[model samples]
Target: MAKIMDRLLLLVYSIIGFAVSVVALLLVSRIIPEREAEDWVESLYGTDRLLQGIVITVSVIILLISLRFLYVALRRGNASSPSIDQRTEFGDIRISVETVENLALKAAAKQRGVKDLRARIRIVESGLDIMLRTVVDGETSLPLVTEEIQRAVKEHVEEITGIPVSSVSVFVANIVQTQTFKSRVE
Candidate 1:
């Protein structure tokens, strides 16, 4: 919602600036006499008169307004509709790897079979890759538990964050025993 408002504001500003510039240009052109073009130029440049001041002020204002419109349009274009080259930033803007890893860890921990989870993130040539190591209960079926954990984590991470997860490698490092000795004996 806020983003839409910002884009709308930029568009309005750009339109206003462009309209002002066009109006100023038209007004200036109308004020200049047709037959005395050369004399007007010579007098304006040669003598610092009122007409010269008006022309200078209008020209400066038009130039500034045009530049402002161009800048706003460029900025809004980059934000709302970005090109292929503008999609990826050169330095420190790669957030997919970290975001995917964090989401994966959180998802895996929430699964029924998963007792604990450890996730590792790696950035490859293709995209973001995630490796999750999950500990399950000893009573849980190994294959089924691992598969469920993988599916749950992958779905959650991909749905929440717009990052594509290349791979989810689930390693069952150990099985956790929640039953106490007394409970077992009883």
Candidate 2:
């Protein structure tokens, strides 16, 4: 809801900014006469005098607006990290999604026979659902490996975040054979 509101606000601002920019360009086009621009270039195109400083003042406002938007964009870009809010007795804590992902990956990796792991987190009504895609050794027991992965991921994520995990779904994507490089000397 808040994100939607923010996007709407940005839309409104962009519309207003586009309108203002158009007006500013139109004003600039009318302000400086091409024929006498060289003579009045030092005096704000001489329109500052004709308009009693309105030209210079408006131009300065536009410049400031452009700078302000640039600063806001930079700030927003830097704040793109995703966080989940947890309510505790003390207050609210924000946890980064990266931390949760790392925990899930680590849990899956701890299981023997797992060669590669991929984890994706989804929010459901219950809390979080962790979906894992795993690559394991060809000789591994599929049932045991998947069961272990599910249990491990669920336990670690719930214990760390204090958030109930609705489910841990494990998909065995591939069974890879171990390969060792051999060197031959002739």
The candidate 1 region of ten consecutive residues with least summed lDDT is 78-87
Off by over 4 Å in 2: 1-78, 179-186
**Candidate 2 lDDT, tens digit per residue, 47-118?**
457654776675676666566657666765637467778788999998777778889999999999999988
CA lDDT of each prediction against the hidden true structure: 0.70, 0.80
Clash totals in order: 0, 0
The collision pairs in model 2 are: none
Off by over 4 Å in 1: 1-96, 180-186
